[model samples]
Target: MDSTLPSPNPALLVPPSMPLYDSIRGSIFAPSPTVLITTILVIFLTPIFLHFIVFHSRSPISLPTFLLVGPAASGKTSLMTSFESEPGQPPVETRTSQTPHSLECFVPASIARTSEYRSAHDPSLKAHKRFLLLDTPGHGKLRHIALTRISSTTIRGVIFVLDSSLTDVRVVAEYLYDVLLTLQSSATSTTTQSKKLLVACNKSDAFTALPPSKIQKLLEDEITKMRVSRSKGILDVEDDGEGNDEKEWLGEGGEGPFTFQSMEEVGVEIEFKGGSVENGEWRNCLSPWIGSCL
Candidate 1:
């Protein structure tokens, strides 16, 4: 017997042709109308489809959190209760608290999630984006509670609740100065996203209550004064060799008066919103994230 078998026939090796083969072969060489349409659709739709996927994947894996901090009797507790209350139920009674209390709250359906896409029904929206809301004692002695939490990585934002009718604006501004300054320090070392701060002017219904915009102005003026005083103190310490190691200004340094907008330079976004927590006006005025972060 011969050692090698006869060579295989090239004719037998060719693939069998099917009914659709000629048409597909023809389209590959010169695209038909259907092929051209499909190519055009893919070219146009691919970017949009990829964008949707990218945005959808960015939904936060862990629950976002917000901390409530302000002067004592600023109604932080009341605001928390008002937010956590079930729809149609009477408002929850609130009292002064000495310790930080945290509760889970869901975003209102009316508030859309940033992660949502147009075609996608928004699972994040439907789930209402559960978040943690921590109410910390606002007492001067107890302020460390809120300020300490500000450094935690889990805290996504801060709400500085204040009595709009406050007789002395310095008290509110001082506490806020501490909060923002702490946030400014934190923003320095952390590479994480910037934190948001909302000045919630509570008790909007009070006759003496200042509008949130006015309150914002008062705070800016007071903080500017505080910054100047602090700079002088830092200079004194530096001269004495006690030493200043880092920048302490809350925002940009300029001869001009300070504004809340200045905090943006330090990665803290500030907003002023006034509402009567007593009457549920917060639902209409507070940030949508406030509802999302119970």
Candidate 2:
């Protein structure tokens, strides 16, 4: 055989293209309406598809929490219902909650102090400005639910709803006293950030409802009495190395009466406001206070 077998026939070396292959090639290169439409759709829609994928992930977003706490029948759940209900609709009926319940709420730009003054329809306010309103059980046995939330959650603010129509307001004051003490101790030990407390006097529509001012006065007097009793008890206990005596006090340590103003020293800013959810009044009134928390 010749050393190179007659240069393997040149025609055999060339790739023989079948008609099917050529037809397929022609269809691809010659853009049809369908191909053009598909290409254009991909080019235009890819970005939006990616945005949906990246922004709308399965993970949950964390929002600042505002705790609602008070004695039983103080309308904490009713307040929660008012916030969760739609505007212009009747407020939802609420039962006494045994566990913590959280609802999402957004403060509109028109009244939100955290947001710049702008049109209420601003789109940015819909997403960035939101918070959770956490309602806790008010019964004595269940109140630990609220206290645990205070210690564990990133509590942005606290709403202490008190029934102004209560015949014996001392119970309300005692509960509030314990809550304030808890907040005060946390404020002292924690960083310097000031905590906001809104003393919402609910059921102001009642005939015998007390005004915010009167409620504040009564609470001050009751807290003063509480401080005295607690101080005496502290003295009765064995004196450990810890400063239990000073820690037990609510406001400025002295013989003077305890006032809400005195709580400022412990980084607690207290505000008293009266409103009745039944009258559809407090929602708007609370906007400014909630805004301040943001």
lDDT of 2 by residue, 1-294 (tens): 557655578777757876688888988899789988999999999999999999887677678889999998889888887877776677898887788888888776545665667556777667546788999888999888887677544788899998987677788888888888888877888885887799999999999998999889988998899888888777667465444556677777745798899899888899999998887777788877888777
Cα lDDT computed for each candidate against the true fold? 0.79, 0.82
What TM-score does structure 2 among the candidates reach?
0.75
lDDT of 1 by residue, 66-122 (tens): 898998888888888776775446568878899888887766554644543434565
The model with the greatest lDDT is 2
Quality of model 2 by C-alpha lDDT:
0.82
lDDT of 1 at 70: 92
Best by TM-score: 2
Give stretches of model 2 more than 4 Å off. 1-59, 116-128, 238-245
TM-score of each: 0.73, 0.75
Candidate RMSDs in Å, in order, are: 13.5, 6.8
